[model samples]
Target: MPLNCGIVGLPNVGKSTIFNALTSAKAQAANYPFCTIDPNTGIVTVPDERLSKISALIVPKSLVPTTMEFIDIAGLVEGASKGEGLGNQFLGHIRATDAICHVVRCFDDPEVVHVAGAINPLHDIDIINTELLLADLETVEKRSQRVEKLARNTQDAKIKTEASAVAKLKATLEAGKPARAADLTDDERTASRELFLITAKPQLYVANVDEAGLANGNAYTEAVEKRAAEENSQVVRICGALEAEIAQLDPPERTEFLESVGLHEPGLDRLIHSAYRLLDLITYFTAGVQEVRAWTIRRGTKAPGAAGVIHSDFERGFIKADCYACEDLFKYGSEQAVKEKGLLRSEGKDYTVKDGDILFFKFNV
Candidate 1:
């Protein structure tokens, strides 16, 4: 899974700050507009307690956790669709991501100037979303122009199907709705995927609050939450400054700091986990004496597809998979115990991999 989420919003809304905290990559989070001109991408390990538990059980020499990528894209302005403030470059970066994390400023700090001159989350969200919608509209229109001509002149079934999909997408984008909202069949969706519309990607709204507003959100966050509900999206509230400071501490000190703050975990962990789920991804494990490793796969991936995440040879020579739920391990206390209790399963290619599954792949290779 090379899939990644793009952190995007108007300038000075803590997109880079959150990104820097998320990856601890030092992406130059300044209090100025367009500070991040180039997209900064970082690989982040997904926090999973099961990985540690599996390591404890197997006593592996190495514990490898699954990872996901995050891209910090430059902020978008009001006229982004018309190339305002390097908008074209920024939009291109967003188009390449699998999902979106729109960071909305919910705290009013006079020192950190708001790009729109006020902390209005709903307005800010509309600005970025409108730009994305406009960009998608343009893409659909351009693609429709070429495809429509071919579909009318030639009776090719493939060309006609593509033209129909393009028309549906154009109508949806023109109405200020995302292409994802359009009623398209499976074949039409397959055809429309080639368009690569930014608005078609799943999105999560990130409400960046001050420390005081982290536990109970402010008015701005409430507004963001309301809008997200209307759009059937999720919102994750985080204190950007606090998380940035937390990112600088050692592991032990970090735990102490969080405990002192009356918190169990840093808010960045929740944000990372939310972004991972936004991609509709799930994790499965391979535990052994050599290593206890977590692997990422899409939600409905079959046994062979899950094995392919390890190596192509595993998929090619796949025989079957010996699998058991991690919860079964927790119950039985050992693999032998799990097998004795008849909790282990031997699944073939048709078996869909479940999250937290402990798998021993059987492959000739």
Candidate 2:
């Protein structure tokens, strides 16, 4: 999976608004549909409280936070799969992303026009989901025809495996299920990954609520929660307008603003943290008196793969790493204390990394 998420939803649902708040970039947010023609890509820093504590101790020359990309895609309307309202064009952009953040407008505003005529999250969700399903269905059916031809001529096991995989995908799509809904073996999954089907990507719902619903949530948000529960998806309720303003504040003022709202941190932090978890991403740290930095890796990443994310040379060296969990530092009060307590240890190439790990790599140039 790509280490990024794509923002998708109907037009005028504050998709661009939330995108701007998340990235701190001004993508045009207007009252009309299809304002975002091309997708806007932004890199957002992943916030970690542990990074702050590490920084306090290390006092590095500069601090660089780990980041994830978010792409703001154009709106999708009804009949999008059949080429309605720039449907195919937008769908192509979504397919390129690793995950999807579906923005639903839960706040009612007469000024900002609703493309669907009213605020109905379930209806809006159906419009986008149906289009994606249709697009994937078309792809599966087309591939199925070609695969059947190969299956007839070839006796090779690989060809037969692909043929069977495509047939299975076709059956699922025919039954109005997504390609992800189909069961496939490890080999079949490897073959299917080449297709990069949009419906196969994991998704989370983002309910953009008004200020009144930001804390406890309102009726529209309640409806979204119910629908998300049925789909086995997660929903995050936030006020995009409020977040935009908070993004512009200075650090001190930002803290005060959050306090006034009875929040210890911005909602965007929770959104970012949730997105990280939703992607099954984990963080590992490189710490020292010289520098302390956070790195992102997949949950099951081994030592070498995690090292490669920092630099290819680190992986090429293929040496051992001095590692300890960040919690050990917090618990024991310092690296020296942790070392004395026997919390620090050496890990080899096959070692699987854990979240909040503090690593010191020993390698020859």
CA lDDT of each prediction against the hidden true structure: 0.92, 0.88
TM-score of 2: 0.96
TM-score of 1: 0.98
Give the per-residue lDDT digits (tens) of candidate 1, residues 67-161: 99999999899999999999999999999999999999999888999888888888899999999999999998999899999998998988899
Q: How would you encode candidate 2's per-residue C-alpha lDDT over 1-365 as one tens digit per residue?
A: 23999999999999999899999898999999999999999999999989988888667776767989999999999999998988889999999998899999999889989997988988998888889989988887888788889889989888788888888887887787777778988888778887788878888899999989998999999999998888778898889999999999999999999999887788788888878888899999998767788899999998888888988888888688899999888887888999899999999999999999998887665
Q: How accurate is candidate 1 locally (lDDT)?
A: 0.92
Best by lDDT: 1
Best by TM-score: 1
